[model samples]
Target: MATLARLQARSASVARQYYYRNSVVDVFRKKENDAAVKIQSWFRGCRVRAYIRYLHRAATVIQKRWRGYLGRQHYQLIVKLAYYTMKMNLYNAMAVRIQRRWRGYKIRKYCFNYYYLKAYLKAVSETNEAVREALEEFADMKEREERKADLEKEEKKRDYQARKTHYLLSTKQIPGVYNSPFRKEPDPRELRLQKAKPLTHPRPKVTPKRSASLRNWLECTRARSFPRSAVLPPIDRKPCQGPFRDIAEVLAQRYKPLEPTLRVAEPIDGPKEARAELQRQEWTRNVQDKLFLPFSSYHKSKKHIPAMHLSSKYGPDSYGSQHFREKNPERWICDKDFQTVLPSFDLFSEYGKLYSKAGQIV
Candidate 1:
């Protein structure tokens, strides 16, 4: 019963103190009332002195009430604050336990893994050591064989030198190889000796036959020794001269017919089949209408064989195709009879005036 009454009284006291402090702070803050009070105090000095004394007493009470309020609030919050602190401490302790257990588990796993790796490494090291020992033994055996070969070679070289000296001194002619282990010229020595011809003249028995055209081509391509000022043979010239004509006429003349201008007649969104058919027709027209070349369209009735590398740039890494073809003639078949088979200038001219139009011969 006494504790309950004390609790009620304590709460009421805290409320009264909080309200009283608020009212005092409010009164102190009012500028108008404060100025009026100060004016009135100047007029009534004794009453103003008594009011000042009362105000002093109220300020002391307010201060004491504020201190008591703070103490009571602190006392009330202690249980809750302690509860939160205990909760936080418990959480921290549990987290630490979990972290320690996890760390222990990880450490144990890591140790097991490390042991497994160490065992595997030891096994590998043992295998490597065995292989290394075997390799060492093999290397020693090889060294011994190599040493034996070296000794034998030295002895053979000494014996050969002695034989060579004796043969040179006695017969005054270097003897042929006698039971030599080392390599000599004309590799299979016996057959080379059996079929040996005199070394004085090294003359071949049969002369190689060659095609005249191939020979001429080879001679033309190959470098020949001559006086520096000597004239080289020129490429074959045109057999006949071109008919005399104005340069403007020759340049302006077109060998191929001018293509007719195409026009879109209407905004026609045709079906797939119709568009495909139109594309096919266009392709056929393009194929039928020959593309003109300066040489082939004007001179040859037949179309010129377009060079595959006409537009492509050949870098220095690749050899010129013309030179490659001329050098490797076995890649082609040649006629021995026709040494000068190329046409002359008469082929291009049809008896005088140059025709601007092409013939549909091809």
Candidate 2:
């Protein structure tokens, strides 16, 4: 009985121990599963945050690049606008300068005209006053002489009548001398007639027709030579002096047919050919020191040619050789290894030949 009871108790104890061990293992497994689930959730959350951060960073970089591109484009547009504005300002300034010069020219012309007219008027007034005084003196002298001649004729009337009758009959063939009233008249008692000396001087001859015609033409030419103020007014006693009507009149006659004013026309745009020529000249100058001088120095020393001949052929600065190479590079080749292999000949002759060949090809 004692052996049976001890075995039963030991079996129960073993069963209880196994049950506790299994429960503890179950609890450990549940805690471990919960920890694993929490860990996995945290890991997943971290990956989502990392992905969001990466997206935000990429967006910021893209926005910054876009803004920079836009800023550069706006800056370029502003520069172009400024350049155009500057060009227009320069054109306006040139136009203004031209207008100012034209205005100055007009003002000078007006001043000259005003002064010249004033001087001419003063000269004309003086000439007129002198003419008037001379005419008045001549009139007074003529009146006195006419009265003396009348008194002498009255005193010798009778004598003069007798002499006149005799003289008329002797010198002329009268148609009816006997029936004339003057033949019957008696001479005045106080008359004492003096024999008149034969009138030697004939009536002043009238100008020939041809000479009369030329008089006007000569007067016109004379008038053109002098200023208008120099000419005197026509007076009965003396002829008018000098040529032309006045200074103003003379100037008007001379200038009427000419253009009144001049203006500068706008400058024409340069031709494409001319622009190309300018560019070519600029390019030639840029390369001249670097290329032509070195080539010329090498050619003169190596070829044993006279400096004068080289200068004549290539010009003082080897212009011909450089020009030839620039215009027709295909005709002349330069080896990379050989720095002094330029053709040895008169530069002018070589250039002439090349031009002739080119002309023929064209």
Error of 2 at 232 (Å): 99
Per-residue C-alpha lDDT of model 1 across residues 27-106, encoded as one tens digit per residue? 77788687899988777998878899999999999999999999999988997899999999999999999999999998
lDDT of 1: 0.60
* Highest-scoring model, TM-score: 2
What's the CA RMSD of model 2 in angstroms? 39.3
TM-score of each: 0.20, 0.24
Clashing pairs in model 1? none
Give the poorly placed runs of model 1, Cα more than 4 Å off.
1-43, 74-79, 102-111, 120-362
TM-score of 2: 0.24
Q: Please list all clashing residue pairs in model 2, or write none if there are none.
A: 158-187, 158-188, 223-243, 223-244, 228-245, 228-246
Residues 1-362, candidate 2, lDDT per residue (tens digit)?
Answer: 89889988799888999999999899799889999999999999999999999999999999999999999999999999999999999999999999899888988766557767788887787788788878877887787778777777764664456455543333235423333545554233212222422223458989855332324533446645533453443344333355424434434544345332212132233333576898889888793544332356556555443476655634355447443333344555662222233444455333422323322311
In model 2, the worst 10-residue window by lDDT is 259-268
Cα error, candidate 2, residue 97 (Å): 1.3
> After best superposition, candidate 1 residue 61: deviation in angstroms?
0.9
Top candidate on lDDT is 1
How much does candidate 1 score in TM-score?
0.20
